[model samples]
Each structure stands twice: as C-alpha cells, then as structure tokens.
Target: MIFYGKQSIAQSDIDAVVEVLKSDFLTQGPAIEKFEKYVAEYCGVKYAVAVTNATSALHIACLAAGLGKGDVLWTSPITFTASANCGRYCDADVDFVDIDPSTYNMSVDELEKKLQKAAVKPKVVIPVHLAGQSCDMDKIYKLSQEYGFKVIEDASHAIGADYKSAKIGCCKYSDLAVFSFHPVKIVTTGEGGMVLTNDKELHEKVLLYRSHGITRDPKMMTRTADGPWYYQQIELGFNYRMTDMQAALGYSQMQKVDEFVSRRRYLAKRYDELLKNINNIHLPDQNEDTDSSWHLYVVRVDFSKINKTKQQIFAEMKDRGICLNLHYIPVHTQPYYQKQGFKDGDFPNSEKYYEEAFTLPLYYSLTDEQQDYIVKNLVEVLQ
Candidate 1:
C-alpha cells in the first residue's frame, strides 16, 4: 500500500544513529549541539534550539513570545492543533484567521480585518505554512508592523521550503520560526523539532524552557552556586530536550535536505503533468515567488461536476489501497475549539477546503510508476 507521506531513510541515517548508540552520552551530547548549529547555518539564522518534537517547539516559542493571560494569539484555522494549542498552553486566548483559497495559508486580509476591529490587539500571530508551501510572509510581516504584534512562523511543513528567495526558517520575516522532523515530514529524527530565531533573548528563553527552566551559567543565575555542579531552576519549564540519538539522525538527514526537496519537487511536477485534465479535480496552486517542499499533493474536487461526495472518493480510494487523507478539518470545527465558541461557519474558507480537499501521495521515496498507478486509479474512480 502507498502512504500519503513517508520518510526516506538511507544507510547514512542508520550509521549516524548507530554511532550515537555506541557513544558515552546518549542524551544531551555533542551531537545535539552539532545538529542545532547545522540547522541554524542552513536557515541562515542566529540560533536554533532542538526539542523532542514540533509541539514542544511551538509551546516554547509561544512562551518566548511572552504570551500569557489577557493576551491573544492568532493562527490559521487550517493548521494542526499544535499551532493554536501552543497559545492555549501559555494560558492565552487562541483565535484563528481564515486561509487563502489558493494557497491554503493564513489570509493576511482577514488578519488585518480582525486586528482592526479588536478592542485588544494580538500579542502574537502564528502564521502556518500549510502543506509545505511558504505563506506570504512578506505581507504578514508588514501586517505585524502595522498592527504591532510579534510573528511566529509555524513552519512545521516547511523545513526546506523557500519564501521570498530565502529559506523558510531564516526568520527574515518573523520573530521566530519552527520546523518538524517527524517520520512523515521532509526529514526524520525519530520525532524531533527545532526553533529558529535571530533574537538573542528569545533563543535563551527557548534554551531555558526546554530544560525545565534550569540554568547553570553564572551570568544567568540569580545567585552564586555553592558548587560547580549546582544549577538553578529560574523559570518554570519542561524537559523538551532532544536526545543525542535523534540529533545524530537529524544531522545526517540534514545532509540530504536539498536532495529530498529536489526529488519531491520533481514528483510534484510529474503529478502536474499527468493529472492536468482529470474530470472533476483541480491541482494545487503555486506562488511564483516561493517554492514548496511538496510534502502533500492536495487536489480539490469540483463537486459541481461530480456525482460522488468527497467521503465516497476517500472511501473508494482507501479500498483501492491508496491512502488518501485531508490536510485538515478546520481546527475551529474540532470539538475542543467549539467549546471555545468557535463553530463550523467561523472560518468559511477553511471549512470549505475541508469539504473539497484530500491529499495525494507525495514523498521522497515515491516512484513514478507508483504515482501513475495511483493517478490512474483516481481518474478511473472519478470517471
């Protein structure tokens, strides 16, 4: 069976993990520092803090942004729960902006409209780069300036993605950016994430919060330590540190990031060529100024031209051994968010996207033959 997305692991990745296993330090070793430095250099950022997963990265990023009670955080309604949940973790109000119909990223117009009408402005805005495509961060950054809010790029699906001629994690347009290395993402570290920033204090905050708010540095310590081994818990934090094993794997994967992106782009091009005129389906749209990592190739079904429901298409695809999936179901439509007074029609564009869109298989290791087979089956089903 084909997957919607899968990691492309090679021998080098395995060797890196094995070497870490034989080393003296299994967790919090030199490899973690090396991986962080490598990612920072790649993204052209001043700092990168490694964490256990993207969720932890987002949570710490929110905390670093000084999000708290009496403040509000906004993100796209089409994103995974972590994007909004991070704000809730900081005890702040969480809200969502509708997505752009074409890009499926946060709508800058809607953001401005919301900010303009609000009595209290947002403390932070987390614009998600959905489906591995970079959001129009230039516009979002301009909005942040006009509205006086900090920007956090929830770029979990955009590790190798490019935005306005620079890498997504460069933080050129946002105060901080996040990346994920889950098994199904562009790269895998057995579940890892990184937060990137140019702000010195924000980087330090992430470091402190990742390690239970403990600090051993004399400069950061409130008082002198009695012994060299003494450390202080200066702030409340969680143990979100990445392990040496995961770091080693991530570092190795970093070496092939460009290669992986290139392959995914090629696959997306092939899909574009082969599926151009399928009966009731529309391919993903691309921005001329940005390049996508093509993590998931989502197509929209034109229900007006089709007799079958999206639910039927998904069920039939699954029965045919093709694992079709939706990018999201509108986070505000989730039961938990509904309790927060968010309901079905709150974000119309995102809810409409949920009704029409489903992901096609797109991954580093997907072959042309498999793609063609999957497409043929899909075309036949639509026919």
Candidate 2:
C-alpha cells in the first residue's frame, strides 16, 4: 500500500474545503485571492496568480513572456510534457536542452553551446526544477541576458525549495516561476497552480489572462467604460481560473508546507544514510548553497555493475509491493516530439538518465518502517 507519492491531508484542509462549500461564492471568490496572497508571501515574491493547474500556469507564463507563432521556446528534455507543451500552446516552435548528469536539470554548459551554434535565437527558456531541486538558475539567467531571451522557471517540483538561501519562486533568478499544487506535490489543492513574478507588468498580464482575457479594471481597459457592468476581452485567453474551494484547501495546506518539508527532509536523510554504502546505486545529488524539498527521492542504478537489468529491478520492486516509478522519459523521445523532428540521439544524456533512473516512495506520511521495507526489497531484488 506504499505508493510512490501521495497527498497528506490534515483536518484543517478538510474543514477549509467544507467551509468553502458552505460559502456563498464557490468558484471566483475571496478564497482564491487569499490563497494567492499566501503563496506570494511564502515564496517571498511580490505577486502571484492562481490558476487551474501547473500546465495552465505554464501556458499563461509563456504568453506573458511574449511567446507566439514563429518564436522559439527552449527547455530541458527531462521533464513532464507540460513544460514543453506550454510553448506549443502559444503556437511557437519548441526545442530542448539536455540535462546535467549529476543534478538531472538543464545544464548551463549545454545551453551555452546551443546558443553559440544557433541560427535563430530562442525567445523563451524554461528551466525545470526537477524533483524539487532548483536548477542552476543564476547561470541560466546570465545566459538569458546575453542572448536576450525571457525565462520562466518550471518549478512544479520545487515549491518550498531554496536556491542560494532564497526561496525557489522568489523570481530572483528568472523572469517568472510556476508551481504545482497537485495531490502528489508538497502542497495540495486537489488540482491547482500559481505563477509568481516580481515584474508588475507580467503580473498584470497573467491576471488578465487567467479569466478569459476579460478585464473589469478601468486602468487595463482599451476603451471607455460603457457602464458599471463594463468589461472587455482585451486578448484571447483561456478559462484557467482556480476555484475558491481548491484555493481554500490550498490555503489550509500552505499552513503545513514547512512541516511537510521537514518530514521529507528527515526521510531523505535517512535514505541517504541507509543506502550510502550501496556501490551499484547513487543517491540524489545536492548542489552547493541549496536545499531541495526532496519530492521524489530518485536514485540512479549502475546497470553495468549489477547482475540484473533496470527492468528486472523495477518488476521485482513492484511485485514486492514497493510501488516504484520513474520520474520521466526524455520528452524529446515522445511520439509528439519525434513527429516534430526530434528523435533518438538528439539528447544522449537525457536518454541515459531514462535508462537508469528510478523513483522511490516519497511523501510526508511515509513511515520509517515503510521506507526501510521499500529499500530492503529494492536491495534484495538488485542482488
């Protein structure tokens, strides 16, 4: 019964959802704005816009970054499909940068090499914080400056994480950041997301885009107001608004983000110590001056040294009820991306990661006993 990842719901979260259900406003109400405020403050960012999901947040973030038809959007290949799909949704060309073998995030070195050899400069770059570990954003932001591209940090796995002693969503290293609140994430709102930005203009643009591109405020209106019931569709946008019920659950969950992270940290430390001597497996990496939220607890298997294959190990773990998983397959190798002209050998490092990576059970409520059982089964299977 130990799933790879699961939401930890508290009594407060349930009560908050119930309160929202009993309230007069269910969809677009005070709770939504309240949740936004909570996230903004928590991340140390100036503004935040709540949305239906991380995918929608990424889409709007791309729009706010001025991506459109004929423009090129670049991101790491080792991420969920949503990271790259945001660009396609804007009718832009999408490309990928390979990842660093050690951290499993986009490599600044590869990004620089790609820029040097490019005939067309990318207009947007999304650096994903895979598995709640922040990417090397300062270096990426430096390249962004030299190349004149906007950056959207896809921090779906890194809500409470920190880079260089600052919160991940602070926008200190990128133009904007997106966070997920799906059930498996550190925080849960049933299904929700938020985009963070310090730039007032981008914040306003996202706000406008969240609600069908309709603006009721006079300042953003392109024309004179018709009456008190006046509103305008300033741009073509989507119905990406989050509901008050979800926001209420998020708000309550936000109160426990620190506690959740602490428990995950403790569990991760235990795993590190317990498995440190296993020569055939490597633990997750931690860069200098950063702390991850320890989202997935992915470990890499050295298949060349082991008697069994990754497939065999995975099957054994599952058969023993460990519920192991892989964080991703290289996105460029997906059928959709292959049709876009990307194929095997386009990104060797990401493909290599796909071959060896495996995710262990990670969540706030995973007991020490459960984790030990999981690791014991994995070790025995590997032998």
Candidate 3:
C-alpha cells in the first residue's frame, strides 16, 4: 500500500552514518556542531540549536522566550498537541487563534480581534506553518510589534519552504523558528529538531536549556572558579541534545534539501491538477508570497455530497490499496483541552477543518503511476 509519508535516504546518507559509527565520539562530538552550522547557514540564521525532537525544541524555545506562569500563549488550534503543550510546559496559559480558510494557517484578523477583547494578553504567539504553507508573517510581525508579544514560528512543516522569498527558518518574521527532522519530514535525522534565531542571547539561552542548564562557558559563569574543569548550573534545563549519529544523517540529507522540496512541489501541482475537476473535494491553496514544502497533501471532502462519512471514505480508500490518514483533530477539542474550558464552537474554522480533512499519500518516492492509482481510488470512493 502507498503510505502517506516516507523518508528518502541515499547512499551518501548511509556513508555519513557509517563514518560516524567508525569515529571515536558518538554523542557529543564535531558532527553535531557541523550539523548545527549547516542548518544555521542554510536558513541564514545566526544560530541553530539541535535537539532530540521538535517537541523538545519547542519546549526550550518557549522557556527561552521567558514564557511562564501568568503568561498566556496563543497559537492555531488546527495543529498537533505539541504546539499548545509547549506553552503548558512553561506553565503558561494556552489559547487558540482561528485559521484562514484559504492558507489554513492562523488568521491575522482573528488574532487582532482576540487581542482587542482579551482580558490578558499573550506573552508569545506561535504561528504554525501548517502543511508547509506559511502564515502571513508580515502581518503577524506587525501585530507582534504593536502588541509587544514575542513570536515563535512553529515551522515544523516548513524547513525548506520560503516566505516572501526568504527561507522560513531565517527568523525574519518571528523571534524564533523551529524545524523538525522526523522520518516523514523534508529531511530525516531519525527524530531530531532544531531552533533558529538571530538574537545572540536567545540563541545562547536555547543552547543552555537543551542541555542540563549547566554551562561550560566561563563568560556566562557567576564567578571564575577553579580551573578549566569549572562549570555552573545557571538555570533549570533538560537533556534535549540531538545525538551525533542523527546529526550526521541530517547533515547528509541537507545536501539534497532543495531537491526534496522541488519534488514535493511538483507532486502537489500534479495533485491539484487532477483533483481540481473532482467535485466534493477541496485542494490546498498556495499563498502568493509563500513557497510550500508540501509536507502532506491534505484534501477536504464534502461528506454530505459524497453520501458517506469520513471514516467510510477512508476505509474504502484503504481497501483500494491507499493508506490515507487525517491531518489532525483540533487541539482544543481534545479531552485535555476540554478541561481547559474549550467547547465544540470555540473555534469554528478548526472544527470544520478537522471534520472534512484527510491526507493522501505523499512522499519523495511516490511515482506518478502510484499517484494516479491513488487518485483513481479516491474517485471511485467518492462515486
């Protein structure tokens, strides 16, 4: 069966891992630094801190931004739980912003309205680049400046994507941006993530938080201690460091980043062309200023018109050798957030999206023939 997402590994990637295995150091080594440098340079950011996963990266980023108790964090509810959970990790109250129907990212208009009536302002606003399409960062940045709130771009799906001709991780539009290197992402580090920033202090804080909050840097120490062996625990932190083995894989994958994004875009274009004529289905739209990485090919099917529930359509597609999946359930609708006082109608746009959306097979290795087969199966299911 054709799966929704898969990694594309080359002989060079295998060779890089083999080389790391033969090396003396495996975890804390030059490879990790090299990978960090590679990503920083690629994204045109001053620093990039590699972490165990995107969740850990988000945790450190939120903490570094001074998010904590009494602070409220706002983000799009149409995302993975990690987006909101990161705020909770900092003891900050989490809130949701509705999404734009076209781009499916956070709606700036909804955000402005919420800010106007908000009893308490958010300390940070995390705009997720859902499905690799960027939110309107210029507008978000303007709002952030006016409201005096920090912006953390949850760009897990947008590593190779572009916003206003600039790379997504450049942090041009936000205070900090995060990227994922999971197996299904544009690149794979076997389960790794990175945080990018231009501010030296924030960058340093991220590095400190990713480790045990201990610092080997003598400059950052409160007082000069004994010898080179001297170190100090500056703040509370966690073991969120990415392994050198994973970094090596990421370093190799970085070489073909453009190719991976290009192939995905090509496939997305084809899918759009094929699905445009099909009724009862809605295709993803690309923002004029944003270049999407097309992380997942999600479509919204009007179950009412198709005479089937989403589950029935999904099952039919699966039986026809298509391994389809759903993008997400609205974060606020989850049991945990329900306790947070969020109900069904809290965010209408997100609830509507969750009800109709499902992801189709998309990956670097998906052949045109496979795509045609999947599309054919989808057509049959709808009929």
Candidate 4:
C-alpha cells in the first residue's frame, strides 16, 4: 500500500553508515561534527548540535532558552505533541497560539493579541513550520523583540524549505531552529535531529544540555582539572547524543537535499494542477514569502458537501491500497492538555483544520504514475 510518507535512501547512504561502522569511534566522533558542520554551512547558521531525535533537540533548546517552572511556552496547536511537550519537559506552562488559516502555521496576529492581554507572557514561542511552510517569521521576530520572548522554530518539516531567500534553519528570525531527520522527513539519519543557532552562548548551552550538562572544557569548568580525564556534571541534562552511524548517513543525505526538495516541489505543483478543478476539496495554501519543502500534501475535504464522514473516505482510500493520514489533532484537544484547562474552543482554527484535513501521499520516491493513481482513487472516493 502507498503510504503518506516514505524515505528515499540511496546506496551511498548505506555505504556511509557501513563506513562509520568500520571507523574508530561509533558515538562521540568526527562524523557527527562533520554532519553538523555540513548542515550549519548549508543553512548559513553559525553552529549546530546534532542529537538523537527532534524531541530531544527541542527539549535541549527549551532548556537553553531558560524555560523553567512558572515560565510559559507557546506554540501552534496544529503540530506534533513534541513541539508542546518540550515545554512541559522544562516544567514550563505550555500554551498555544492559533494558526493562520492560509499557512497552517502560528499566526503572528494571534500571538501579538495574546501577548497584549496575557498577565504572564511566554518565555519562548515555538512556531511550527507545518507541512513544511514557514510561519511569518519576520513579524514573529518583531513581536518577540517587543515582548522580550525567545523564538525557537519547530522546523522538523522544513529543513529544505526557505523563507525570503534564506533557508529555514538559518535562525535569522528565531533564536534557534530545529530539524528532524526521521525516515519520513526530508532527510533521514535513521532518527536524528539538529539544533541550529547564530548565538555562540545558546549554541554552547544546547551542546551542554544535549549530553548530561557535563563539561570537560576548562573554560566552562568551575575549577582547574586534576588530570586530563577530569569532567563535571555542570547541570542536569539528558543523554541525547546522535550516533556516528546516524550522523554519517545524515552527512551523505545532505548531499542530495537540494535534489530531494526539487522533486518534492515538482510533485506539489503537479498536485495543485491535478486537484484544482476537483469539487469540494480545498488545496493547501502557500505564503508568498516562503518556499515549502512539501513534506505533506494535505487537503481539506468538505465532508459536509458529501455524504461520507472522514472515516468513510479513509476506508475507501485504504481499499484502493492507499493509506492516507492526518497531520495532527489539535494539541489542546488531547486529554492531557485538556487537564491543563485548555478546552475544545480554546483554539478554533487548529481544531477546524484537524477535522477537515487529511494528508495525501508525498515522498521523494513517489512516482508520477503512483501519484496519478492515488489522485484518481481520491477523486473516486470523494465523489
């Protein structure tokens, strides 16, 4: 069955991992540094810290941002739970800003409004790049400056995406940005992530937090070392280091990111053309200032116009040997978040989007013929 997302692995990817297995160091080695440097250069960021996964990356970024008990963190509700959960990991109170209907990203207007009225402003605001399209980072940055909050971009779906000529991970509009390298993401490291930042202090903090807050560096140490083997646990942190094997594969994947993004963009345009005339189906909208990576091709099916529920449509697609998926359920609607006092109508846009949207097949390896077949089945199912 054709699924919503899949990784495109080349023989070189395998060779890179195999080569790492033959190398001297498997874990805290040169390969991770190499991959980090490559990604930092590609995104035009000053520093990068590779980690085990995006969730860990987010957690470290939150800690580095000085998020703690009594501080508040905010993000778009239409994202994976990790985006909001990272705040909870820091013992920070988590909140959500509604999304822009057009971009499916955190609305700067909503953020500013919330800030204007809130007695407790957020310590950090994480605007997720949903479906690989960037939120209005320029405006978000402006708001952050005015309100004195940090910005951490949840760029898991947007490694190869661009906003106003600069890549998403440049951190020009945010203090730090994150990228995921899961199998279904733009690039695969068999499950890896990187945090990019321009600030040297934040970069150093992220590095410290990702690896148990330990430091062997003399400059960061509280006292002089007794011997070369001296180290100290400076602060509480997690074991979030990425393996050399994963970094090696990621480094190799970096070589083909441009090609991968190019193909995804081509497919996205093709889908737009193919679906334009279809009835009662709204296409995903794009923001003029951003170029998306198209990690997901989600469409809102007007179930009210048709006789079927979303489940019926999903079942029909599955019967055609296609497995579609939903991008998210609003974070606040989850039982855990509801216990935090966020109710059904707290964020209307995300909830509405969740109800109407379902992702179509999208991946680097998806062929035109396969896409056409999927589209045909979707059209039949919708009818």
lDDT values, one for every candidate: 0.92, 0.93, 0.93, 0.95
Per-residue lDDT, model 2, residue 222, is 86
Tens digit of per-residue lDDT, candidate 1, span 341-374 = 9977888999888888999999988899999999
TM value for model 1: 0.98
* lDDT tens digits by residue: candidate 3, 1-383: 88999999999999999999999979989999999999999989999999999999999999999999999999999888999999999999999999988778999999999999998999999999999999999999999999989999999999899999999999998999999999999999999999999999999999999989999898899998789788899999999988888999999999999999999999999999999999989999888999999998899977778788888988888888888888788999999999999989999988888888999989889999999999988998899
lDDT assessment of candidate 2: 0.93
lDDT (Cα, tens digit) per residue for candidate 4, span 1-383: 99899999899999999998999999999999999999999999999999999999999999999999999999999999999999999999999999988778998889989999999999999999998999999999999999999999999999999999999999999999999999999999999999999999999999999889999999999999999999999999889999999999999999999999999999999999999999999999999999999999999976889989999999999999999999999999999999999999999998899989999999999999999999999899888
lDDT, residue 90, candidate 3: 96
lDDT for model 4 comes to 0.95
**Where does candidate 3 stray beyond 4 Å?**
none
Which pairs of residues collide in candidate 2?
A: none
Candidate 2, residue 101: how far the Cα is off, in Å? 0.6
Considering summed lDDT, which 10 consecutive residues are worst modelled in model 1?
A: 302-311
